[model samples]
Structure formats: structure tokens, C-alpha cells
Target: MSQLVSLNLPAGTTVPSHADVVIVGGGIMGTSIAFHLAEAGVRNIVLVERAELGTGSSAKPLGGVRATFSDPANIILGQRSLRSFEDFNYRFKTDIGLRKVGYLFLCRSEAEMLDCERSTHIQNGLGSNSRMIAPTEAVEINPFLRKEALVGASFSPDDGFAEPEKVVQAYAEAAVALGVRILEHTEVMDVASADGCIRSVTTNRGTIQTNAVICCAGAWSQRIGEMVDVHLPVTPVRRQIGMTPQLSTPMPTVPFTLDLSTTMYFHNYANGMLLGISNSNQEPGFSRDFSHEWLPEFNAAARICAPALVEPELAQGWAGLYENTPDHNALIGASKTVEGFYYATGFSGHGFLQGPAVGELIRDLYLSRESFLDHSSFSADRFTEATKLFREVHII
Candidate 1:
């Protein structure tokens, strides 16, 4: 947690009056879009952030990356994102701290194990090399796990974790180098549209007249949608994490392990462990205050799943918001009602890992070119349909 490599916009840089594309929210999603758009030869692109980059949920993620999803679209997105992270260091000259040790998802019940098997089958079909493993094999992969506690587990060697803040900064710096204007501390007041198309974006700095505006605002996406009269179904749910004090003894190299039954997840971080448990009673809003009441429950879960590790004192903990939707999936692509407005929010808790591929997809959508990944399933229009929405079952 040392000081992040500076990637801020130059001092006293003025906001432009017009641009080809305007992106709101400077988190992983927005910065990723800016980088990809600029890489694709879009020069006059502006990314405006109300705060510093990665100040939102992007900075608070557990940094888990996996392709073991029930939905094919999500699996494809994960695969492409993994590829991007693999090449990020070479492309950006910045190491994103990607650790591809693996992702181990443990299921306690037979029903959950069946779901894992089904998801693993779908993932393998889509070129994801994830597979259901025996409880003993799960222990073999990560010796710290309690094998008796897991009914089954699915693991993907290609899936792992990365430094979220570093990834965001890398994307922002690369975007700046490629001619994308990044305006930090600039609040987007309103998005003015005429005849169902974006006309201009009024911000605290100044008004930028642009035909296209991408809403990558993480937790604030709903408000951004309101600016354009689009009812984006996104809510901000607070998620908290606790970091244990660095252990005296060297711990086993563990993958990002998640107990699917309890929704408790943890992974190795530095010389300690970073862990969190999903609060079933968590109310949706923008409040990010950390609560100590959940500590006992989280401790119990850790004891059950990882009995090898003693309950070390929590060095520190913090809370962050998740841009959740009606379904746990993200809302990507253009709005049916708004002609020039695009969306790339509501990833629930998976935005950071999926940010890179989403950026490419958004760039393709903006240019009206064929996307590398099919994004029809992620359209904003899906919410209006009577059919059941695709929910990601592997969410931690």
C-alpha cells in the first residue's frame, strides 16, 4: 500500500469544450474504456472523474479473477480479461501484480457442487480450463484448506488475482499517453441530450459538447443515468474486508479461496491474509461504514474453511461499495431509449477483473464495429424483458 505511481492529469489542465467521446467515472471501468478507446485510434476522448482514479469500488476489490462462471458471456468476458492482464505488463510497462496461482471455489452442499460441475462444464466448453476437483485434490492444491469441510471444489489454473489500484493506474497512465484527457476532481453535473441523443455534458469545470457519453460511474451510475433520464437499475451495496496481521511463519501459497455455501472468501496478500464474508442482511445504499458486528460471523467461517490458520488479530479493515443490479451481472452496452449514452456498470463485485475486456467491448460498441465478445446478453434492454435474467452463480 505504498504511494501509487502518479498518473494524475497535468496541473492546471483545462477541460475541453468538446470531445469525440466523454467517459464518466475514473475507476477501472472508465479508465479501461479510455485506454482501449485511445488505443483504437480515438484521440479526442475525455474521462472525467469526480474524485481521484480508483477511489471507488475499484480500490477495494478482493482482486479475484476467474472464468468459472455459470453464464457463457461472463466466462468469455473473464477469458478475454485474463488475456489482457497477462499482456498488461508488456503493453503498459507496468506490472499489475497478477498472480495466476489459481481460484478454488469450495461448495459444501450437493446442490452447490452440482452447480459447480455444471458451471465448470460450460466454462470448459467456452475454452476455460476450469474443472471440478475432489475434496482431496482441493487440499492438494491448497494445503491450508479443510478438506473435510468441502463437499467439492472447482479450480481454474488460469484464474487468479491482481492489484486493482495498480491496474487502474496503469490503464489511466497508458490512456493519457495515448491522448485521452483524464480530468480528476471534475464532477459531471448533468448530461444534456436533445431528441434522445447526447448533446453536451455539463460539468463543474465546464460544458463539453459531445455526441457520445459513456457512464462508467461505479456506485454513482444510477445518478449518472438520471442525468440522461435513463433509469439505470444499479444500487450501491457496501462490502467490507479484513486484513490479518502478517504471520510469523510462512503460510502456504493459497489461491483465492471462496466457500460458496457461506460466501466467505480469502486470499494471500503480502505476508498476511485478506478475507471477507458476504453479509446477507446488507442493505443497499452508498454507505461504506465498516461494522464490527460481522467480525464474529466472519471468524466462524474462517475457522470452518481454513482451520490451519489461527485467528490472528485483524490489523485493519475497510469498507467499499459494490454497484449491484437486480441480477448479479453487469449492465453493459448502449441504452435502448438513449441513442448516444452507453453503460458499463453494475458488475456487482466483479468489475475490476472484467474491466479490461469491457473496455474493448465498449470501444467496439462506440465505433459500431463487431465486438470480439457477444454483448447482447449484457444489454440494458434485457432488464425490460419478461424472460429470466442471467445471474452469475460464482459471485463471492
Candidate 2:
């Protein structure tokens, strides 16, 4: 996957003198928010990025879009975004390569199976079509897995993966066409606020005098929030995905399957498969260089989940940052102290799937309108306590 070509965007001589709203970061979240705001007829929006668009996490070769979650708030967010992803080609005139093969969470324990059942109940209650299937049924959906190792699994047919780069390209192009200016290679230097309101946004190119600023900076959100004295508790953790070599055997089409206990996941990738394993001990940083340091552990997980994965010689596929919060949930809301400053970030590993819905939510947030879901629970204020806690926390 690659970034949105700079040639495709409107080349600007310099940063605009002013804008009604300045968006920091030009990844999927930022571009999606820009598109939604433009669709709402909001003008003079400027999206400033330090580098080319989609070079961040949004450029991942493939991203899973799902609405299956235990939390009611998250379920609705995913549901709304899933609808947007479904109508993307019609609404934005871009095919995102959306494959609704489904998402199957493989369970290996009774406790995990119970949680899957409970989450499925909540998902279905909130109009999210997710169900618990027996291990045999799961194997039918994804024949690569060993049926005997599973207790049961949660399956969501409405969920699947897509080319994230295309989605980002479409959003950025559409937003720009709607009069939104994108300032590429522009770094935000400082945010000037006074009297509990925003005065202007200072960048390397120039300052944008705006009343509102939205930090869609993803992993860099912590620093962006600090500019206005807003505490956005976001941490950047390096997440890597490995691409196995092309295999001689025909790879069967399968859902984006994940191991509930191990957090090991894999799905069809070209002639081989794409794989990722959640490393709990990975340090938080902006480092995104792919490495083979975790292969042993990943192979350990594959042994229990899918033994065949251990025999392949995998290449270092890609590395991206997962904007994580203390509880592994997102931080979305306005800053009480810095009145006009708001943030929509820290989705852990679920940002792309929920980007569209967050865009609508951020629009309502900036306009002071009632949103579809109660975003109070996702506030950054939850991290003020000494110990990390949230309404719901999931590792993957």
C-alpha cells in the first residue's frame, strides 16, 4: 500500500492565511472528518499534514471493517461506519475492495466463548448482525483452522477487510474537491489559545487563524492536545503485519479470522496470507519499521491456532502505529478547558473501521449538536485516575 499521491491533490504555494476549521493529520480519520464536514456544507476547512496523506496507519495494505463489539457505544459507532463503508462506492464513487467474507473470532476456552456469546447478544440488540457459531461452523467459514481447538466463535457477516489506501485517497480527493484545502508537509508548530478559546493555529508554513481545531493526529495526538493544555491520553504502539510467501496450494477464501485468546489473526492475502499477532510487551513509540523479532512468538501462537502458518517463510510485511489509550478504547470529545479544541483519536486498533462514524460524531461535536451516541464515556477525563480503567477494554 502507498500514500495518496501528492500530484493528485491541489498543489498550494503556501499554507492558507486562515481557515474556519483546521484539522491536524491527513490520515483516514482526518480525511474522513474533512469529507463529512464538507458534505455538511462546512467551508474553509484546512487539513494540515506533516507528510503525504495515508502514509500513517491508514495506508495498511488491508484493514478490517467490523461493527462487532461488546460495548453498546462502540457497536453503534461501528454500525454507522459499516454502513458508510458499504455505501462508499455509491457515496464517494470509489471502490474500497470491500469483501464481506465475514469476521470470525476463534474461541479456545469456555470463558472466552461465554464472552463471545454475551458480546453477540449486545451486538444483535444494537442492530449489529453478529452471532455465536459452533467450532465446526467456524471451520466451515474458515477451513484453515483446527476445529477441535475451539470452544465456539463469534461471527459477523457484515464485517470484512478492504484496501485502506484507496479509502484514504477517495476521502482526501473528495474533501479537496469540496473546497477543503489540504496543506501537505506542513508541521503544526504551536496552538495559540486565549480566554478558554482558540485564537490561531501556528504551523511551519504559516498560522491559520481559526476558532476550532480538531486533533485527528492519531498516535501524535498526545502532543497536539498538550499544545492547548488538553490531556489527550494517546500512546503510539508499533503494530506489525507479516506477509507470507506465495504458496503452491490454492488458498481458500476465509473471513478475517482472529484468535480470541492469543490475539493472533490471519486472512487470505494474494496468493498467501496476511498475519498479525498482538504483542503485549511491545514498547510505545513512533517507531514503525517492520522487524522479524516477533516471529517466534507469532509462530508459537500459530501452533495452537493454525499450525500450517509455522512452515512458511514470512517476510516483514508492514508496520504501523496503533494509537492506544490506557483502556484500549478511543478518546473522542471536546476539551473543557480549551473550549474550541476537540479530538477524535486513540482507537487502539479499530480506527479505520470506525473512522466514518467518528467523522460524523466530530462534526456534531464541533457544531455542538446532539450526536448518535453518547461520547461522554470516551472522554480523555477517564484516564485522570492513577490506575488505567475504562467502560470497556479489548486488546484487539
Off by over 4 Å in 1: 1-14, 308-311, 387-396
Q: List the residue pairs that clash in candidate 1.
A: none
- Tell me how many clashing residue pairs each candidate has: 0, 0
| TM-score to true structure, per model | 0.93, 0.93
Model 1: worst 10 consecutive residues (lDDT sum): 387-396
For residues 1-396, write the lDDT of model 2, one tens digit per residue.
344444233444557788899999988899999998998889999999888888877878999999888889999998999899999999889899998989999989999988988999999988878888998899888877888888889999989988888888899889988888887788899999999999899987778899999999999999999888888888999998889888788878999999988898999787789998888778989998888776777888888878887755775489899999988999998887887888999999999999999999998887778989889999887776433443334332
* Candidate 2 TM-score over all chains jointly: 0.93
Candidate 1 lands at a TM-score of: 0.93
Tell me the whole-model lDDT of each prediction, alpha carbons only. 0.86, 0.87
Q: After aligning candidate 2 to the native by TM-score, how far in Å is the CA of 383 from where it should be?
A: 2.2
Candidate 1 lDDT, 1-396, residue by residue in tens: 233343444566557999989999999999999998998998899999898888898887458887778989998889999999999889888888899989999989999999988999999998888988899999999887888898989998998999898888888888888888888888999999999888999988789999999999988999999988887789898888888888789867888888897788888887888888887778888887887656676768878878755464688888999899888899998988888999999999999889999999999998899988888888767776633333343342
